[model samples]
Target: MNDTREDMANRVFLISGGTSGVGKAIATGLARLGAKVVIISRSADRGQAAVKEISEATGNSRVDWFAADLSLQSSIQEVANIYKRKYDQLHVLINASGAVYFKKELTAEGIDRMFAVNVLSHYLLTNRLLDILQESGPARVITVSGHPRFLKNPVINFDDIQMEYQYSAMRAISQSLFARTLFAFELANRLEGTGVTSNAFHPGRVKSNLGRNAPWYLRVATPLVNAFFKAECGIGVYLASAQEIEYANGMFFDEKKRIIAIHTQFEDGAGNRLWTLCEKLTSD
Candidate 1:
């Protein structure tokens, strides 16, 4: 932790979805350690609020914000371009931006809203910033993933990648999470020996605004569930600052510690397919 803290000072971090929830916590923790934090958000008002809160809370005025609709590839590319123009290097890139839709819908881009926000945005943004991350050497990429028990096989439906044919609240959320996990692992594989490490984690059921899209009953139950089972921002602090897992790549964690994903398919050949699909989707 000491080493991580010492190394973090003066370094740059770009965190998507840092406006609230676990992402906000991580941004605040890193800023306290003296890192130059750049938070990307869809709304300027929310972004400014988060930047002010983080700066005041940590007493680190280096915190800044970028506004972009991550659900759109063009917006993500623009944000990346702005980041590159402002900062010469990025020491860490945290893909913490995610969302769940109570009902199936498509974005203005004609892509499923869930897939666009939860999976595609991270995919496009990470790839766009890969060069600077590699140039920064010893950089880290941490993705916030979810843990959902599924009743059916969690395979990518190439025929209808965005759940256009069939959709349910749970199924839509599950699909995006599965895609995110695969992208994290696939990213690790591609970044091997590049001094860039990629990993994903389940932030452990925090009482965050990520669930605002849930039904009325569940939204009402959020406080109770969090009271009994939610985890603190400490786990996020550990993952970002702990020295032991600095070199750890292609791994999935429950919280602070590394844990194996029960299904072997998570590490199987599915990643290649997903990667290929992502490449095709994001290609010009």
Candidate 2:
């Protein structure tokens, strides 16, 4: 992967949810390659700790962080503004922040917490930074998605997008995952001729604290499940740094780096619908 590192060095990568779990793993991997990795965190103390940990682990001091609550659109926009004000170039953006809520909840912005963090956050953050990505040219936007096998019959309930009527954690998480993938593909379609590309990938069953908000029993079992899964995010790192797929767009990749087809259902203009909905929801 020397070539990957060579390409990554001196480049800028901004990652959400980089303070821990899959985001942290990818951030560490990128930092080790000498890339300027900036992570977003909801807590400043946690963000600083993660930056220190990544820097110490990778021996790369360019790793830094910005604090932003992914559940809030205002916070995301503010962080994007901060990033643009502080940095001039952005080579890659990894939308790795995710959340799983057992009960239905809404943010101060009146958005479903899971939908806000998992889908809209990716949408707004990427859209906010699109201009910079285009200026940077040959850049990429990689979104984290669920395993394709688990999303066999992916369908988005546009009418109940917020899960207002009946809320099940499984249903909420699945819909968010599907919507995020759809957003990635739609983004690619919109960015067809632009120098920037958009794609999504499943980082495999890596150890993560996504279940931290679950019930106590589930929280207690998270470590055991995580112990049985791989921890390193090689696929995320590969997708972000590999030069071969620099122009790859609207693709879904597995942990093995193989491209998976977008579900045919998504081609029915669902992406555009989702995009429009996000536009309305996140609009000022």
Candidate 3:
């Protein structure tokens, strides 16, 4: 399914956490297509190697990587500014990094690491790069969510987004889902008329390391789920090439490019609420 119509020739695709898993898959794929790919990762060594691997495989030397920990708000600001100064315009921003922690961890900024990495980092990165994205015009921000948006554990206890008060596996998963839906919604709302589409995807239970830190049951069962299904890391490109907000700005997806629209949580009210809360927390 080569999508040459996308015309990504001179475009730049910036993705976080591109050293491994689905991030690596998309980074490499984008590079092969002649789009200048910049992979932002945590480790300089790993980041450079990822860029090298992509360059070698694609025979496209336009790929590069830089290191930055996205969990901290300050780090995100610096990285965003760096990208703005470095690139004239960004055609695509894939905020694909995510985390699911068994126990609570805090960023240097004292925010919950799970929320900071999975939700807040993506939020701040997208907002900070909003100028570049809009300047590029017709840019796309494809965030990685999980399966069946409705089947998700969907409890949005705003009082417990961090799950610090009463932490549990279920609570963490549920809160993350709620936050993602709301993030997509609010981002799409804010990007209206800018031609910068902000959408999220359900990458399915791929053979990825998403549950590496989870309990034995989760860690053990994820492979089983992938084995019983088609686990193509390149399924990400299906998302990468899909009609950019041709239907709706903030739609969800299932495994096989199926659109999932459980709209209650992604509605305007919930989206606004989440946006306001995040604003208070970051207070930039």
Assess every candidate by TM-score.
Answer: 0.91, 0.97, 0.88
Model 1 misplaced regions, further than 4 Å:
1-4, 148-153, 226-231, 261-263
> Which parts of model 2 have CA positions greater than 4 angstroms off?
1-4
Give the lowest summed-lDDT range of ten residues in model 2.
1-10
So what's the TM-score on candidate 2? Answer: 0.97
Residue 165's C-alpha lDDT in candidate 3?
A: 82
Q: Candidates 1 and 2: which is better by lDDT?
A: 2
Sort by TM-score, top down from the best: 2, 1, 3
Better by lDDT, candidate 3 or 1: 1
Better of 1 and 2 by TM-score: 2
Q: Give the per-residue lDDT digits (tens) of candidate 3, residues 56-168.
A: 87788888776789888888899998888888988788878877888888887889888888888888888888888888877788887776635344657677677778778
Candidate number with the higher TM-score (1 or 3):
1
In the range 1-284, model 2's lDDT, one tens digit per residue, is 23236667779999999988899999989988889999999998999999999888888889889989989988998999999999999999999999998999999989999999999999999999998999998899999998888768788999999999999889898999999999999999999999999999999888899888888988999989989987679999999998899889899999999988865656488888999999999882
Candidate 1: pairs in clash = none
Better of 2 and 3 by TM-score: 2
Score residue 168 of candidate 2 by CA lDDT.
Answer: 89
Give lDDT per model, in order: 0.81, 0.91, 0.76
